[model samples]
Target: MRTYWDLCVGFARTGVTGYGGGPSTIPLIEYEAVKKYKWMTEEEFGESLALANTLPGPIATKMAAYVGYKIKGPLGAFVAIMAHIVPSLIGMLGLLGVLYTFKSSAVVKGMINGVAPVVGVMLAVMAYQFFQKGRQGLGSKWMIGMSLFSLCVIEFLNLHPGFVIILFLTSAFVWSTYKESGKTLFTRKQVMRSREEEL
Candidate 1:
């Protein structure tokens, strides 16, 4: 149970050093959430990361808000959001004053080029971890099938992804509820097997 001030301080550090925008900043958020603060486990971070990507808006800010609300309340959310933006706001102001002075520097260009691969690797690692988390959940076989189906729908069928997201979410909720209630729907084939042996 951290205070609003704690949330502000913690999120502020990430906001200040979070270079390369939303996708790249994710790994930094993961470090703060899972490593430094232990606010969430690695698996929880992976799942939350996936959820954040699904929603609209900036990924880093979304994650920050989620974390703040989880630990505190709406006031903490406000504080966290403010802290996350302040650094970028201040940085931009400072940079604007000296923009022309450093814009053409070769060293600055080199630093940007160098950070690209690191950010890519971090995103790759996060993706892999999330993949593993998804593969381990209930209806995982259907999950695998849907992954391919989603790609086909997007690439070949040209369906909007929001529709697919809604479809899968609804189905998963229904499936999970049925499974949890011990009520089988598509278990006609298994009805006979249960009398003789468990499947």
Candidate 2:
């Protein structure tokens, strides 16, 4: 059984230092869960990430809850979720205090302006990591296609993210079932191959 301290430390570290946004924080969470703790294999982490993306709420919190629940059920989930959120909660409060006191500080203006470059870097890294992880799980060429398709739909069509995710999740289920049943619903050549195998 994993101890509370172990869970707290691992997730707290992620929460405390995961600057920028949830996408940027994911790599940090992956490092602790998949690398430092051995809580999940890389493949499992990838799968978990996919599943978490489908769920409602912030991806980081959902991920922490899933990992913790896997390790120790409901109680583990509670601890992990709290650990993941506590740092952000404290940081927000601190920032609010700073903003209140430094409403007119030039230092604050400089800090905000400087953060854009760093955030851009973080987001770039996050996007690249997502590409690599998706490619590993879903082939290099196909990953690019899917990424482009998702980007276009999200940006051009302006569809809600939840709707898009649900659409893909349903598509994946149907595709997987077809593959498992040896049914070639989408290709005439594969249908013929399955028939030939039967003979």
lDDT of 1 at 74: 81
Task: Pick the lDDT winner.
Answer: 2
lDDT of 1 by residue, 123-186 (tens): 8997776667778774678667878899899889999877787788788789889886665544
Give candidate 2 misplaced runs (Cα > 4 Å): 183-199
lDDT of all predictions: 0.80, 0.85
Model 2, 1-199: lDDT tens digits are 4567788999999898777778767878888888888888877887888889888789989999989998888999999999999987988898898788998899987877887677678778767877898788789898998888888999999988788889888988998997966654557778788999999
Instruction: Provide the lDDT at 21 for model 1.
Output: 89
Q: Output the worst ten-in-a-row residue range by lDDT, candidate 2.
A: 180-189
